[model samples]
Target chain A: MTNTTHLIRDARILGGERADILLRGGRIEAIGPGLAADGAQVVDAAGAVALPGLVDLHTHLREPGREDAETVATGSRSAAMGGYTAVFAMANTDPVADTAGVVEQVWRLGREAGHCDVHPVGAVTRGLGGEHLAELGAMADSAAGVRVFSDDGMCVSDALLMRRALEYVKAFDGVVAQHAQEPRLTEGAQMNEGVVSDRLGLAGWPAVAEEAVIARDCLLAEHVGSRLHICHVSTKGSVQIIRWAKSRGCDVTAEVTPHHLLLTDDLAESYDPIYKVNPPLRTAEDVEALREGLADGTIDVVATDHAPHPSEAKETEWCHAAMGMLGLETALSVVQHTMVDTGLLDWAGVARRMSETPARIGRLTGQGRPLAVGEPANVTLYDTSAERVVDAAAMASKSMNSPFNGMTLPGRVAATFLRGVPTVLDGKIQ
Target chain B: MRHLLSAGDLTLDEATLVLDTAKELAQVGGRSVKKLPTLRGRTVVNLFYEDSTRTRISFEAAAKRMSADVINFSAKGSSVSKGESLKDTALTLQAMGADGVVIRHSASGAAHRLAEWVDGAVVNAGDGTHEHPTQALLDAYTIRERMGRLDGLRVAVVGDIRHSRVARSNVLLLNTLGAEVTLVAPPTLLPVSVRTWPCSVSYDLDEVLPKSDVVMMLRVQAERMNAAFFPTAREYSRRYGLDGDRFARMPDHAIVMHPGPMIRGMEISAEVADSPRSTIVEQVANGVSVRMAVLYLLLSGSGSGTGN
Candidate 1:
């Protein structure tokens, strides 16, 4: 029971005018220039930019299995440190979050952890097999009340199954986030299909493999009049398709990962598996196109897709190693460096893309609220001028597979208030 | 060089040094003693994840001729099959005082990964479809031994260019050696990014055969058609196969070469493979001397001295 009152002083709200914020009983009591409350914990937040706490629509907690890689408690702590107030945990766990029982168990674990609200994303297929549909209605009606369904790690490749899943989710106002990839076109794929894969003689993962699926799913969603969300749009061709779909007024939304907006396939030249990912990192032109799409609202939100792996999974040879990188802890810093600091998006735009829009997409009612009176006190204070050299050993997650280990990135989270309860203070988890 | 992982890492001077050393070392194959004391105390380990009896034996013979101790570690029946990772295997070899590791893996860039873990010199035998640097060296040696020069020679590498590690290394090395190389393969057989390679690509094999001073044929795996890369074995052999009719179009001084265990009826006909112009047999013989030169240059501090 967190009932403590907190007074945050001289913070810039939403990159706007500096003011004092008074939070009491998990609600914003007042916002003014010189607010004072007796017995309130005073946080000297001068020169910090305050925004709505971030929300991640895609994060892999790796619980109920693969605890050696990450657990709910560890992953949530990482999210809280990254200024995320809510996260939709992915459905690619060991038992697969397809049944009501699994999602309820994950929800209870998140409540116990008390760092961030964990919304378990139900699997659209049984065990993500891509053959048959899972119990979508049961999961939506469960205590967890899963509103987002996805077969993230594996694409719902079968067309009929995808169309059925999209239509079924509409009954409960749930969105089907598709991991767009054509399996046959990406057989034995190692990296992006381009000059780099050819020079290295590695197997090529062509962009058409991803674009073909997104194009098909968009038309299917338009036909069924169901909401569709594309996960991890990685190619320029995908951006063009998504832009065209939005122009057609289809109930379609898309997300670009923090990695996709910054990193490119040239990093794979080192043969380091840490750069390996699904839909593989693409070219510089693709990165620019994704940034443009996000700026123009063609892409709806920025999802972390925070995948963690054990050291053994990433330390092996490139082809034999797993395909993911740590993103939760460094996601905000990357966005600030690539998007905010570059003048592509302002702080208010950052709040909408990173917090408000993701919350709306996942239907997280308690998150992504404005810093105003009577709203939920979920606020993040960020020192925008500060720089951090990412250190994997110092991270909250259990795995050390961070691709940004030695990178010097801008901005640091000073404090994160999850429902007026300070989960992080002075850049340290409380 | 500390590592011979890719032919692209070699300069013209370094490649010429290797070929010149192999030329001097070839005479040792005929000597009664046949062994050199240059690397007498060194240890070389052949860590092979893929089975290739010919390459393994050639490397073994090269190491033995230089009087180095050899240990062969095959993936089958080894700890590698027992779930031990490549890093662990490399650490175990490093602990055993291996001075050099000759690795053959099915994954591209495996040798580069092993080089980062071990302190010894790493030599790539054949890593997936990436590179086989020593094979290129031996091919270069065979070409130079026959024609006595590599400058401005017209070479055509035909068939299965997309899946051939040998063709990749040959193109890079031959281009560095001042030879103009043409990659002759069906459009489906060539990689989509072949335009970026330092060679010209052609679908017609016969058109380039007459102009080619050296013709190298890469083996075509029958399993490629399982992915629909080509139609059938008969059709592929008819169009791209180097029969005697295509061989007659080549210049009189031109040589035919194939890295062996040749499929007689598939990529190259038996007549062309057994012809007097064929250097296929000499390629195998030159593989040992070229490997010896590489091992000596990498391990010994003799500064390219003759192994007397």
Candidate 2:
């Protein structure tokens, strides 16, 4: 093994003391004033803050199904590069992760790669069919130990089925992450239902379609007495529903993607598939509301929901292209831009939303831990001020499908420690 | 610059220039001996992948009227019937030494790809469910000719906007020309994202008729009605259709318009189609002149002139 005598010098240590962290044997040995290390390899943390490794609650590693898009190994590396210590991979693989065997396979692959922990999300139903329940307990007991369940690619449209799915996961405390789109309202849906769709002559995916589902699910969650997590909460109307639900003391949490906070449906005027995502990019007003929701904790976490696809799949016509974009590698930069750059969130807030709150929600133990003595050294050291235009080729994920390509973004990941092991160094996946 | 993809691609400045150029060409048509040498050294190909009569002939006339060498490429009873690909047809057109290509495909955005891949100027005659820029320009030209201007005019576009490419191009160009447009269609016919468009929208045509300086009725295309956007043809015509009774509510100077092949009993009544105020026929005659303007502005190589 390499010499592990590493010293971080002159840093505004995020956990508060004017300290130097000395590392050895893949663990933080000590951190205090004037911690001298003669044989230490030096790292200049000059003006940077040391935060815990970021983690994502939703990411799609389109492997074992559409490997031409993304794989668990590649996705894990992407998470690490993004300074994420762990990611909950969604359960919408080609065969669908409804069973224990498939999820365990994904888990095993993540372990083999060893970049970051890949917690495979189990499907709510067999093949996500929405008719019969899958082996939820078996998956929860499996090696993956999936705590999150979802039928993400399709909405669990049937009211009774949605209620049943929410109730079924109560024993495991698993969140039935609903896609929350009414299929009938959104059939042939191309973009946000507004004046732009009328002008563009494209079909509308209405705000109501998403709002209705989230409203119904929140009440169902209250009735079922189970936790529910709504994926990619995009609208102001949705925020109102979640806000009301929380006020009523219903156990529900919501997430908004980085794209939702930054980009709007106006970008669709170009008809670029890169901007074509599910719960399609909304208006600027929605962007503002979503950002406020995140900052105020109405929206609890910033999940990537990083769906990836091959170039060929996205290169077709707008109506015909695959729905998704690469977000894992760009999530941190987007968060930094939307929150920290705007001064809406400080570094600690970024840590809480991206790491701490997500960890709490996903029930990812040993994660989102503060940088303290005797704690697992899951840390992310970042250059919060450096800038780079993201190139898709440089992403660790297999699919080069990010919309943030050629986008100049501030903040860069310097290093990420997963279980005290440097899984990434200076933005390169280890 | 390479794809003439649609008349919608033309800015107001460009459309005005094209219209002015068309005025000169219309004067040439007025002469007993009608000809031009501007396109003598160029080649123009009309590639119609779908059914055509007016659009095809207008191009043949416009190209021949400009003295350009012309080729008519029809997909009917040809390899396209045998399911020849668009890329294959594009390659075939490239082989024929054509400098200008006018394509009318049933598929929308086909022209967009054609423009990207081809070396010559690609004009969108029409694609499946997209901007028919020339049809819109012609409609605009016919209005501007009779009304003397486009700015501040209240124009209502009524019919199946979800499937109509004509509606797409018109809203963009009309707004650009400083005309206020209100689209009147059932919620099914109107796209979900209509809120983003720059025009006012209404369900009732009678409500808009009093304010409109021009009421342009689009042809009700029956073959394109596939997923049941409206419950019945009669109901769609009843709520959103331009009939004589509905026409009675229009301003005294407000003109009725249709981009031909009108459904006499469906979208508009026979009385409204033949009304003295209806400029439906004027639109057909203006089509050749306006298309000539597009060909001239796009082909004449800085051959700038004034007729406006």
Candidate 3:
């Protein structure tokens, strides 16, 4: 454990007033101009923007099964480098994180890794089969204390099962994150169902397939009085549904991925499998709508949905390749480029969408806290002016399937502090 | 010139040159000595991941007539069936000194990807529902031969336009040749992006049939239909199918064409397919000459004198 104090000098706190922060005993002791503390390691952050550590509501740390693609340790390191203090690990692993034993094991692995808090999301259904509900109460009461339940790689498509999963999560204040896709409509879908899919001869995944399930679940949640979360809302139609659902005071929230906000389905024109993803990148108009949704309050947060896959899985023809792209390491950079630099969101808004809202939606504690005294010192020092071309090979994740490779994105995480302990220092993992 | 990956890759001039060359080569097919000495030492490989006996034999015959060595590599019962990747197969062909590789795969853009891996010229014989450039060339040649020109001609492509690689190639090539093309199919059979294509679209084939110079019927594969693109075969035959009644509605000089192995009773009737105005058989014969021109131009380069 880190028992020493840290003195972060001359940093813009929350992109506001320049101040010095003194961390002692794993909490911010003082925040003021020219703060001095003896026997503390000094971090010179003159031009850096200090904000609350980011949290991801969706991330697939592929362990307990697909180690060739990613493991908990590697994914955690990637998260730390991306300035994330907590990540909700998805439940689509080999044996699937349905039981309390598996959830605790993943949680224990996260603790051992010591980079970030890996909150294991328990599978809503046993083995993610979508036929029967898993031991939701048992997983919530376990040491892992799963506060989020999902059958993410596969949607909980059955209406009865989805309603039941939503109802069951209310007992423990758990949120059921729905991967909103109708299975039959997306059976042979290779990309977004529009002009690009038509041109490429790949099967289309219609926007209605996602919107239909979301519209149904929102009504189910309203009927059952349980909190619902939508994972990776990719279409304008989905955003409209979520907005309408929120208008009626249904306890619903939605997230858009970094890739979906910036990339479009036109990238699939190259027939490159690297651009292939589930709920595939949509059109430019959809991208604009998603951006507007986030800029307003329609879309609640930005989740990485940081899926990782090995080279062989993504190196084949588009139809034959596995679906997913690495996102954890480049998520913030993409956000800064797409949202902040475009003048759509300020740094405070960035903290709200990336850190506060996601943590509140996932019910994560000791995260999404403001940079104030007596608060937990989970802080990220970012250089907003720094620009770097993304190189997938240089990423901390084991997988190099990032769609953002070679893209010039703004901002860089200079350092990250998890409870005053430097997990990433000077852009490198400690 | 180096690769025939798409019909869009050809300009009007290059397409006309290929058509003119095919016309010259068609005469060679009717001669007592039906062989050319243009590509004596060149090797052409037919790498087919999807089975297409018609396209494979046509390319083999084209290469043989040009006096080029030909190798037919079918994916079935081959190393490709043993999980060998397209890259490995392409590398193997590159090592074997293939001068041209004509590929037919079930995946779109397979030939384009193979072109990046090999040093030889790549020809997309048929790649999924993406494009079949030679078929387009042969169709254009037939249209020009029958109608005397492609400029301002009204060409109506009927049936499953969504799944027809032949229709896609023809639309692009025919558009480049200054022809006004119209796609006639049910809304489900038409691609959602058909509006972006260089052609107009109509749901009524009867309306389009009456005002066309050429009616090209794309084969409707019953096996490829997993969902109901149309109500039934009988209903599709009644609506979009080309029968003698629809044939009689066409202008006197208008021709009927089918990229053959036609579903005789489905997309076209037997009588309409065998009519004197039907260029179905001639399309097959012209396919060899067009492919021969493609193989010759790709392997020998444009400036090379015909080594008579």
Candidate 4:
């Protein structure tokens, strides 16, 4: 926390009325029309939209193992640059964050980096092997205070095990973020199982594969009377299932990735591995449905499944390539382009989906707070009118696997303040 | 055409041009000197990541007949098995100044991926169940030769449509050439989205055989039985196999086609394969001409786009 007061002048608060916000003592000191700077460092944030700093519920900071791909420091820098103040780092890492020691190390690395808050999500299965449960209670009890447990890269396919996990996390008020893909059904799935995969001769990932697991997990969560969070809902059927699960009064929350909102399976026609992802990009109908689901509040949050892999991992044949795309740096822009510009969502809705709900879902107290007085000074000023072509090399993440490369997207994060300190300013990492 | 990576990539004009060029080139096989100077001094590399003696020999014969210097790089006992990536292998081929590369690999989209790395034209001989544009071209050529046309002809592509690159290419190429293609196979052997394809599908081979002007039998791998693609070879043969009775039911002018090394008495009986109506031998002979036309078009500037 910095004592140096900062005054953000004339910024639209959540795309609403313009106001000046004062930051002091790690909290919003004041917010009103024409507030005086009072000898503080003044920032000219004219025409930018100010909202609560974004919080990502799903991010892969490949630390303690695959550091060549990403470290907690690099990924934290990436999150902050993407207007994120807090991000829950997933547990599918080397040595796996199933143990308290691993989770604590990741949490400590976040603290040392100080770019953004990193809450380590515990593993649901030991080593994510899908057999025995990890020490979720111990991880929640540890200094990291993990509130999200997931086997995000791999689905927790075992029904009894999924039920037990959903029930087990309840003791600590934790949520199991399921990856939601049936392993056997998606054994050799390379892309969406439809016209494109058929034409390209790549293996198909059926929508039922995801929907079946989601349907089962929703029932499991309901039966166990525990909170279930679905990760990266990619299909229309999945949206319907999740919507049904929600209407049934199942305590469930779901997140849609930024990539899924804008991209589709047609990209796989290029045979480019950059567009290849798990629960692979679906059809245009699925994209529209996902957009509608997010717009209608059926989808709870927009999490950047910011999976980064080494260039070599993605620079190969589509089948031989790894399944993921860099998301953190381009998440906000994609949200703006697909949702805000398309009139499906407004700035406030963007805040709710990208920040508030994600922080609430992860149980983070300081993040996703309103841009008002007496709240934690985690704020992001986004230039919504600005647009630039996405360059993978220009991104902060260690990997260059952004699917949005060369595509122009609206809204650049001008500044991101984590607890009154600027982790990113003037669209550059501070 | 810079690369004949997928039959779907071909337009009607391009597909027709390949067939016409092959028809003219077929005359060379009957000449005193079975050679064309169209691709002389050009280097063609046959990169086989999978063992395909037949395909390798066909491409080699085509390139050699065109007077193009040919280099056969079999993946076996080569740097490919030593864990060298496809990109590295492509770079090595690029370094050797290959003017056109005919690739056969066990991974779908390997040819597409190779096209991205190397500057040479990529002719996908067979890329795991993805595509075999040359094979489709040859099949198309043989059909046009035997039936005198491709338009409005009923071609029944039978067996293992899910795992047959030949079936995929032929379905696409035949469809592009204005032929009506019916994919005949068990539900387990067909793609989930086969209904979306520009072709009809059937579960019963006997029903399709009577209507088809050309019946193409695909080689079903015996290993697929272990995964329960079918109950047993005998059971599969009992239902889907083409024997004398089944072949007799076809239209009198209808020809039998197979992208061979066919499993005798399995997908097709020996009697049917040996029948005069069988274009199996001519298909192989026509393969050389079709491939020659493909290499000539992709390598020479006569085609719309020169190979990069």
lDDT of 3: 0.91
lDDT string, candidate 3, A96-144, tens digits: 9999999999999999998999999999999999999999999999999
Candidate 3 residues lying further than 4 Å off, grouped into runs, are: A1-3, B224-226, B302-308
Candidates 1 onward: DockQ, in order: 0.80, 0.35, 0.59, 0.69
Provide TM-scores for the models.
0.98, 0.88, 0.97, 0.97
User: What are the per-residue Cα lDDT tens digits for candidate 2 across B185-300?
Assistant: 87877776677788999988878899999998988777545567777788878887788788888889999999888999799999999999999888887888887877766766
Tens digit per residue, CA lDDT, model 1, B33-80: 999888887889999999999999999999999999899999999999
Model 1 ranges off by over 4 Å: A1-3, B302-308
Residue A308 lDDT in model 4?
Answer: 94
- Best-to-worst ranking by TM-score: 1, 4, 3, 2
Q: Over the full model, what C-alpha lDDT does candidate 2 score relative to the true structure? A: 0.83
What is the Cα-based TM-score of model 4? 0.97
lDDT per residue for candidate 1 within A160-215, as digits (tens), equals: 99989988988899999999989999888999998899878899999999999999
lDDT by residue for model 3 (B110-129), tens: 88778888999999999888
Report the Cα lDDT for residue B47, model 1.
Answer: 98
User: Looking at candidate 1, what is the lDDT of residue A248?
Assistant: 95
Candidate with maximal TM-score: 1
Candidate 2 residue B264 Cα shift, in angstroms, is 3.0
Error of 1 at A388 (Å): 1.5
Model 1 CAPRI quality: high
